[model samples]
Target: MDLPRYPYHQSLEQRSGQPQRRPVVIVGAGPVGLTLALDLAKRDVPVVVIDDSDRIGEGSRAVCWAKRTLEVFDHLGVGEAVAREGVRWQRGRVFHGEREAYAFDLLPEAHHKMPAMVNLQQDQVEARLVRAVQLEPRIELRGRHELIGLEQDADGVTLNVRTPDGLFDMRADWVVGCDGARSPTRTLLGLGFAGQVFEDRFLIADVRLAPGVRPRGLDPATPERWFWFDPPFHRGQSVLLHAQADGLWRIDFQLGRDANVDAERDPERIRARVAAMLGSDGFELVWSSIYQFCCRRAERLRVGSVLLAGDAAHQVSPFGARGANSGVQDADNLGWKLAAVVKGEGDDVLLDSYEFERIEAADDNIGHSTRATDFISPKSALSLRLRKAALDLAAHTDFAKPLVNSGRLSLPTAHVDSPLSTADAEVWTSGPGPGCPAPDAPLDEGGWLSEQFGRGFVLLAFGWPVQAPGLRVITLPAEGVAATRYGARPGSVHLIRPDAVVAARWHRFDAADVAAALARAHGRPQ
Candidate 1:
């Protein structure tokens, strides 16, 4: 599919020969950068996004958008459009050789606003986000503008940008680096990632089956994630198949460390490998790439006045579909806090919480990625045997099924230990606690519970008439899934952050207690 291109234009700062200081200057125009731009714009904070390129990124890089990510997009006003054009699927099948080990459903129940996941190309997502950014008057997107030098002091950062027109200087109270894994901004900051880089490589091919044609034994039209371990066609290696929007299908083949990278990336070689597995050669190749993944993270997400986000902060293997999803979530986590600080409504320490919470999340994602990599590419002979045995048993015994790890799959990690969370003063059962992503439910008021979130601090009061200054007070009925999902009772109250994380809850409403919790959530000293 053809993608829309954006042309580079000289900025006002460059034309006027003046270094204008912006509220927030974001580097990179990928999905994460654009998401942050849109988020800050929504919060009434002006932001400028700079990228070295004029087009959406190349290839179908991250195709899976998780439920939580979709909810975030909903707040940004593109969730429905993305869901409508993307292929939605909940069921995934894991196969051990020729036998099906297990079939799992991501969302077994209904009534949620979004689906389990959506498969859409990265270029398409970026295009939509760019459109949104163009419409927002508060946002300025400068294409072909690249950050070459950055210096941060107590108050703000000075950036030396290189553009097609010429080199220019700009200033920002805050700078965010949303560049990819090999981030130039991170390099300018003299920081590096520290972690494991697996030698094993993988081949990615986007193949489009001929119209009205399907593989002999495989169903290309079915929107399900299929993972194969030691399949007959691709002996000893693993293969992952995912159906994407349009007639395109994404295929990943494990290529061992010693495999020829150049030969494997050849179009004919990719076709042969895909044909061997699909039992057809009539498909057209859209895009192909060979890559070796690593599980690594920066030492710190924030360094003085500059912040690193998305792949610049952390990077994981794509098996779990965690790369882009986690990056978008990082934007969701940082947008509100940064906006508040820029507006002087929040303490500088609140920005520290962004570092703390996102580092915790990155570490969690890195751990999962490391484990999945080790399992998928066992180095030791004993480890290989053990993995094979586990897969073998998983096909027969229910007990061993839990041992199978085809990438744990991306899920939002609760910031239970975050410093921002207000500890529960009362016991709770079967409900989201502090720092947990708020669960969505169909409200009796005809809209979903999540629709009321993302604007600001939300106080859900059940069977109580409570009011707090500057807080959006939502009185929910004490019935249906909204009440049940929250474990609500009469007089129960829950405080949700702008990012839709539960900050604190109370068994009964008390004005003083609510004030204290709100202050704590805002990162004020208790």
Candidate 2:
């Protein structure tokens, strides 16, 4: 589907005048860029987002968005539309040659607001984010505006943007590259990637069928993730199936490395494959693509005033859905820090934490992605045989089922060693450790623990009154989900960062201590 396009505006340089310098210029209008733009704009920071293409994502590239990413979206003002439009699923069933192996549920809790994951087309995500960007007066989203050159000094970064009118120089206090995997920004900075590339190939097909088309194993009304290892129809390879929103189903065929991409993607071959897998051919093929993934990331995410996020900083196998989700979190991580620095509320050292935190996140994601990739594509003869044996054993024994890895799925990452984290002075039952994301808990009257985070420094104290500048406080009961989840005791306080990460927690602390922690989080000397 074609997405609505915005009119291109010429910069002052293109109008035969000196280039206009802005506070922040973001190159790329993908989910990450738009998200960052929205966040910075919401913080009263003027941001200009430039994109090479006017259209949204061509295909349903990243279909599975994780819960943590949704929370970030909720802060950005597009979470409602995303949740309403996406298909929600929590349970997954694995099959070994037509025999059920085991089942796993990522989010079994019913008290939370969001699901374990949501399935929405990438285009749809971009559409909502783009619309939100357009409505923000502080943001200028220039679609079809391409970035041609980038140069940075100690003080600022300048970019050469090519619009329909002409190529013009645009300067900014900082330039962020959310341009994607083949990021021109990263290349221009001479900061490239280094990592492993698995030789396995996968073919993705999105097909639409009637709501009544029910397969034997699948429940037409309820959605679940289904994975098969060496099914009857397919030889030794694996297959993954997911039910998407809009009456669409996604099938991923584990085509071997030597498989012909051209022949396999042909409609007739794809139809035949679908027919054999479904035991009937009654679906319309919507799209098909072949892909091979690399578990890699850039050497560095930040250099001077230019920074890289999302696929630009890293590229991972889609088995875990880490690429886009982590990218969204990267934007979330940088947005508040960048905005604060632009407004002179924080120093550039705060921006340095973006590299520290997100690169750590990128490594964590790459590790998971690589593990899933290796499991999906075993190397040696013994490895292949062992993989099959494990899957076979998984069909019967519960112990063996845990060893099976049909894509480990996406999980939120923890920044265990972030520099901003203040160590806990005393222990508590369920409180998140410093540098960990604050867990969601059910509130007594009506609400959630996550609802209290994401705006500014949040002080969660039980049975005590604490207040500081730009700090929000939440009073928890002596006993409840919030109390237990936070290990909240009387006089306990937990300081949460704007990105919902715990900066510090105390069994007992003073208001001055909280102020110092906040200053440290903002890269100021305490």
Each prediction's RMSD to truth:
1.3, 1.5
Q: Candidate 2, clashing residue pairs? A: none
Candidate with maximal lDDT: 1
lDDT of 2 by residue, 1-526 (tens): 3466766776556776687889989988999999999989878899988889877767888999898988889888888679888898888998888888889999876677778889988888988998899899999888778888988887688888777777778888889999998999999999969999888889899988755676545885678898888889888788988888788888898998899988997899998988788877788889989898899999999999899999999998988688899999999899999988888888789888899988888888888888777777888889889888888898778888878887777766778788888777665566688888888877777877776677777888877676767788887876767777777878888889889898988887677888888888888857
Instruction: Kindly give the stretch of ten consecutive residues in candidate 2 with the minimal lDDT sum.
Output: 1-10
Q: Give the alpha-carbon lDDT of every model.
A: 0.89, 0.85
Q: Measured by C-alpha RMSD in angstroms, how accurate is candidate 1?
A: 1.3
Candidate 1 residue-wise lDDT at 497: 96
The best candidate in terms of TM-score: 1
